[model samples]
Every structure is written in C-alpha cells, then in structure tokens.
Target: EADIYQTPRYLVIGTGKKITLECSQTMGHDKMYWYQQDPGMELHLIHYSYGVNSTEKGDLSSESTVSRIRTEHFPLTLESARPSHTSQYLCASTGLAQETQYFGPGTRLLVL
Candidate 1:
C-alpha cells in the first residue's frame, strides 16, 4: 500500500461552491506536492511544500491553495469551485534523500 492518502476520493460540486481536498502521508516525508491532471493528459504541478511553514505555488496557475503546517500533512483548498476545475488531483511525497515520489490515490472532482 502507498504511504500517502487523499480524502473524499471523489467529489461533485456546483459552480462557485468551495471545497477542500485533504492529503496526508505516514512516511514522514518533508517534501510534498500536489498535481492536477485531466484524463489522458499530462499532470501539472499545482502546489508544493518543502517542510512545515514552507509552501510554494507550482508551475501551473491554480485557484487552489495548499498549506503545510505539519511534516505529514498537506491539505489543498479551492476557494471557489468551477466546472473548469473538474479533474483529478494527485498528491505526492518524497523523502529529503529520495528521488522517487510516492503518489496517493487521486481525488476526482466534477463541478457542475
């Protein structure tokens, strides 16, 4: 089993509604990342954190925000949901000395 976890594996929301997707890992990796992907499309990095109290926006422009206050927790929040936001959100983590990233089961979102 993967060490990472994502809550609410699927979500359906109306436009303009707010939502939050939770991600956590038991592996105690200091680096965590969030990626957004469409079916059959390449994944885009949306947010990332290096450690507690350090967070950064990723290469992609995302309406979602993420916070990292603990070593094993990284939660993403979308202030306003939209149909355009419908896609899969994936969470990943890597140890400081590791190059391989372990991914969690992605959360699929559908905004109506």
Candidate 2:
C-alpha cells in the first residue's frame, strides 16, 4: 500500500476541455514527481519538485504543468485537452531518509 493519493483514477474528456490531476501524499515527503506513460511502454518523467517553491520540467516535453505550493500536494493541469494527450499519469513521492518512492494509483486519461 502507498501513502500517496491521486484523484479521478480514470478520466475521459473531449478536446479543448481543461483538466487537473490531483496528487497528494500523507507521508510529508518533500520530493515529488509526475510521469507520463502509455500502456506497455516505459514511463517518462514529465515534471518534478524538490520541495515547496521548487519545480522543474522533466526530460519529456509535456503540455501539462505542475505546481508544488505545499509540501504534501502536487497537482498537474492541462489548459486544453487534446487527443494526443491521452496517457497514464503516475504520481510519486520519496521520503528524505529512504531512496524508495511511494506511488499513487495512476490516473488514466483519454481525450477524444
């Protein structure tokens, strides 16, 4: 079981709709990340934050944006949804004392 949580475990939206994926951790982790993936494909890191007020875009280019204003919450938002944006979003957080990361149940999105 993981302490991290993700809202709207599954999402279906039309093109041009705005959507936000919420992620939160109960473990008080300072490091959090968002990954984009397709079924049967490798995960791509899309965004990350070291702590509050610190965020960086990841290796993959993503139209979505993320914010880390509080220590336990990190949310990803897309201003306008598109069919090309369909993918699974995974949220993870790592404890300061451990290298292991706790992952939330991924949000599966489909934009039609």
Q: lDDT at 24 for candidate 1?
A: 95
lDDT of 2: 0.96
* Candidate 1: clashing residue pairs, number: 0
For residues 1-112, what per-residue lDDT tens digits would candidate 1 score against the true structure?
7789999899999999989999999998999999999999999999999999999999999999989989999999999999999999999999999999999999999999
TM-score of 2: 0.97
Listed in order, each prediction's TM-score against the native is 0.98, 0.97
Worst 10 residues of 2 by lDDT: 95-104
Please list the C-alpha lDDT of all candidates, in the order they appear: 0.96, 0.96
What's the residue-level lDDT of 9 in candidate 2? 99
Residue-wise C-alpha lDDT for candidate 2, range 60-99, written one tens digit per residue: 9999999999999999999999999999999999977779
TM-score of 1: 0.98
